[model samples]
Target: MVARDAQDNVSPRSSTTTVTTGAACGNPVCGVRQVTTDTDIPWGLVTLPDGSVLYNRRDAHDIIQLNPTTGVKTNLGTVPNVQSTDGEGGLLGLAISASFSSDRWLYIMHTSPSDNRVVRIRLENGRLNTASEQVLVSGIRRNKYHDGGRLRFGPDGKLYASTGDAQNGAYAQDRSALEGKVLRLNPDGTVPSDNPFGNYVWSYGHRNPQGLTFDSQGRLWEQEFGNSIMDETNLITRGGNYGWPACEGTSGTCGTAGFIAPVRTYPTAEGSCSGITIVRDALYVACARGARMYRAAISGSSLTNVQTYFSGTYGRLRTVEPAPDGGLWLTTTNQGDKDSTPNNSNERVLHVTLGN
Candidate 1:
C-alpha cells in the first residue's frame, strides 16, 4: 500500500503480512529496531510532511529534528519561557498545523512560570523562530505534577488540547476552570462559536488526560491517567461529561446519571498509557508504568481484541505515533520514571513494524 498525502507526495510502498491461526508468529508486531538513543525523555513525537520527525525533550525544553533514514539529528532550538515543574512538566506535546507547508506553524503545549499553556511558533528554514511565539491558550493551573499536556489537530481543522486537573481533583468537575478538560479552539487562539460551553472547553470532568487523536471516522479518542484505581480510554463526544472525581472507569455510576463511561479501562499498574494514535484499523497506546504497548482493534464505536506487548522490554513507554514508513515510532520515558534506575541506555526512540 502507498499513501499520497495532502501535499501530493507519494510515500514508499509498504505492506503488512497477516499470519494464519496456526502460524508461529502470533503477535502482529514482527520487528523492533532502535532508532535513536540517549534522548532526555522524548515526550512528544510528530512526523513532518518531509518525513523527518520532530520530537521534544521534556526537561531539556528543546525540539530536535531527526532524519529517520540517515540517523542524523539537528537541533531545532529551545522554546523560550519553558520551565519544568521537576516532575511531569516542561515541553510536553508537539503538533503541526494543517496548513503547515504554507503557514509554517508548529504548536506546542508546555509549562510556563505561572501555568500550563499552548503556543504556536514558526518552524522556518529548519529552525524554530522563538520570536514568532504566539500564545493560543493560557491560565491553566499548573503544579509540580499532573499538568495534563497534549495537543493535536482534529479532523475538523480545529485545535484540541487536553489539560490536567493540576493535582486538584475538584478542577475536573469545574466547567468554568480550564484545568481537567479538553478544549477546542480556532487556529487563531479564539474559542470556536460551536464550542459546547461557549468557551474553549469541548468536554469536561477529566483528571489528567494526556493523549488525544482522531480515528479514521473523524471521531476523537482520549487516554487519561487515573488517580489510583483505574486508567481510562474514552470515546470523546461533544459536550460529553466523563466522570473523573465522581467516577473512575466503571467503578462509580458511569454510563448512567448523565456520566459517560470509558469504552475501556485498565488497572493503573498495567496501563498508565499516554500517547495514542490509530494506524490502519487499530488504536495504539504507549504505556508508562506498564512498560508496554497496547494494540486494540477498533470495532465501530468500541475497541476489541485488546492485546499488550513489549512488557518490560522497554523500561517505560511514553509516546507512540504512526511512522512515515507505515510502521510506528515509540519513545521511552525511563529517564525520570521513579521505578527505573537512571541509565543512559534506557531513554530511546524505537521503530516497530507490525503485521496485519
Candidate 2:
C-alpha cells in the first residue's frame, strides 16, 4: 500500500505488509517495533504522508516526531505554556493540517498559560517552528478535569474541537459556555458562520468528550466520558445536544433540550470512553476502566453491535488514529496520568490493519 509523499517533511510510507489474522507466526496487529519514544507520556498520534508518525507527550508539554521504521526521534518542542491544572491539564490533543499540502501548519489543543487554546505551529524537517506558533482560538475554560481539548479537521475542512466541562457539570448545558461542548471553527480559528449555535459551538451538553472524528462519509462523531456510569458514542450534527450531567445515557430525552442521544453507551466501571476512531465501516473507541477496544459497525447515521476486547493486556487504550495502510494506530494511556514507569510490553504503539 504505497502512500502519498508526506508534503514537507511528512510522508506516509508503506513500511510493512498488512497484518492478517493468520499470516505472521507471533505478531499480527503490530508488525513494526517501536523505534524511538518520547517518554513524556505520549497521547494522540497522527501519521504524516511520508509514514512519519507525530505524537504529543503531556507532562513535558511537547510534540515530537517518531519514526517506527528507523527508531529516530526529533523533538518538535514544548507546546505553548498552559495554566496550572490537574487531571486534565498541560498539552492535550493534536491535528495535522488538512491543507498541509499548502498551509504547512500543525495544530494543537492544549491548556495555555492563559486558557485552553488551539494553536498552530510549523513542522520543518520533523521539528516544530515553535517561535512562530500562534493561537488559533482562545478564551476556553481550564480546570482540574473535563477541559474537553481534542481537535480534528472534519472532511468538510472545518475544525471540530471537544472541550471538557471543567468539572462544572451544568456548563455542559450552557449554550454560552465554550466548555463542555463540541465546537466547529474555520481553519483560521473563527466560529463557522454555518455553525449550529450561530456562534462558537457546534454541539452542546457533553461531559468530557475526548475523541472527535469523521467517518468515511464525512459524518462527525464523538466519544464522551460518563460521570459514574454510561459512557457514550455519538454522531454529531448541527445544534445537537448530547446530554451530559443532565442525562446519563440513551434513556430519556435529556430534559427536552432536544438532545441527540448516543448511538451506544455502557456502564463506566466497565467502559469509560476515551479515544475514538472510525476505521473502514467500524468505529473503535478506547476504554480506560474497561481497558479494552470497543468495536461497532456504523450503519448510516448510527452505530450498533457494540463489543469490547483487548482487556487486561494493555492497561488502557488512549487514542486511535487512522493509518495510511488501511490500518489503525493505537496508543496507550496508563502513563498518560503522569505517574508510574511505562509498561513497555503494554505501552507500545500498535498498527492494526485487520483481516481474517
Candidate 3:
C-alpha cells in the first residue's frame, strides 16, 4: 500500500501487510438473524436430514422441532422423569442416531431423580414415545451446578459424552470416577473393548466440559468451564488427560508430563463457552457469560486467527450447530442468566450465515 498526496505525488510502497475481515475474508459469521423467539433456555441443537431442527429446553425438559424454512415449531413430547437441579442441570444435549432413518432414536442427557443420565427415546411419527425411553448410561453424579452434559456421536459411530465434576474438583483427577470425564461407549451403552481403560471413560480430568464436536478430520474438540481463571477449548485425544482440579488452563500443574493443554484459553468472565460446531473448516463457539460468539480458523490440530462477534448483542449464547443448508443455528440462554434479568419468554434461536 502507498499513499498519494493531493498533488498526485505517491509515497514509496509500504511493506506487505495482510488485513483479514469477517467471514468474507475467511472469518465466520457474515450475517445473522433471529429465526425464532420466546424460547425457554434452549440448550442442545441438532439438525436433521430433512432440514428440520430439534432442540430441548434446559428447564422445561421438552423437545421442540423447528422447521427452519417456515419458522414453524412443533412440541415433541417431553421426556418423563427428568428433574431440574434448579441450577444448570436439566434436559441438556441432544444427538440424532446415525441410524435414525431406520431406528428413529434420539439421544438425550438429562438430570434425573437420582443422577444425570443418558437415555434414548423413540421419535415415532412426530412426537416422542416417552414409554420407549431406554436409559443407556447412568450413575453420573449431579449437583446444583457443574453437571456437564453434552452428547455427540463420533465418526466411528460410537457415542461420546461429557460429564462434569459435580462441584467436586478432586473427582476430575481420578480416572476411576465417571464424573468430569469424556466417556465413550457403544450405542447400546456397553463398554467398548478398545476404550482406554476398558471402561466407559475415554478422556479424563475435565471440569465442566459442555462443548463437543468433531472436525472434518474426525478430531474431537471440547470447551470447558473453569473455576475462576480460564475457560479452555482443547483438541481432544484418546486417553488424554486435561488437567482440571490440578490446573486451570496450562497454569497449576499443567506443565507436568502426560497432561494436555488447550489450543485456546479465555478468561472465565469473557468465555464460559458452552456449545461448539464446525462449519467450513472454522470452529464457532457460543459463549454464555461473555454474551458473544467466537470464531476460530482450524489449523491442523490447532486454532488460529480468532475473532469475536455479537459481543453483548445477545444476553447469553448457549448452543451452536451446523445447519443442514450450510449455515449455523445458534441458541440463547438469556432466560436464566441473573446478570441481565432477561425476559423469561424472550429467549431466541438465531440463524447465522457465513460468507467465503
Question: Better model by TM-score, 1 or 2?
Answer: 1
Cα lDDT for residue 9, candidate 3: 75
lDDT tens string, model 1, 113-144? 99999999999998999999999999999988
Q: Give the TM-score of candidate 2.
A: 0.87
Q: Which residue segments of model 3 deviate by more than 4 Å?
A: 1-27, 338-345
User: Which stretches in model 2 have alpha-carbon errors above 4 Å?
Assistant: 1-38, 251-257, 336-346
How many clashes (backbone N, Cα, C below 3 Å) per candidate?
0, 15, 1
lDDT of 1: 0.88
Give the Cα error of residue 324 in candidate 3, in Å: 1.2
Evaluate all candidate structures by whole-model CA lDDT and list the values in order: 0.88, 0.75, 0.87
Candidate 2 local lDDT, 63-169, one digit each (tens): 77877667677777766675537466767888876667566688888876667888888877657788878888888888877777788888788888899988888
**Segments of candidate 1 deviating more than 4 angstroms:** 1-6, 9-27, 338-346
RMSD of 2: 4.7
Q: If scored against the real structure, what TM-score would every candidate get?
A: 0.91, 0.87, 0.90
Candidate 2 residue 231 Cα shift, in angstroms, is 0.5
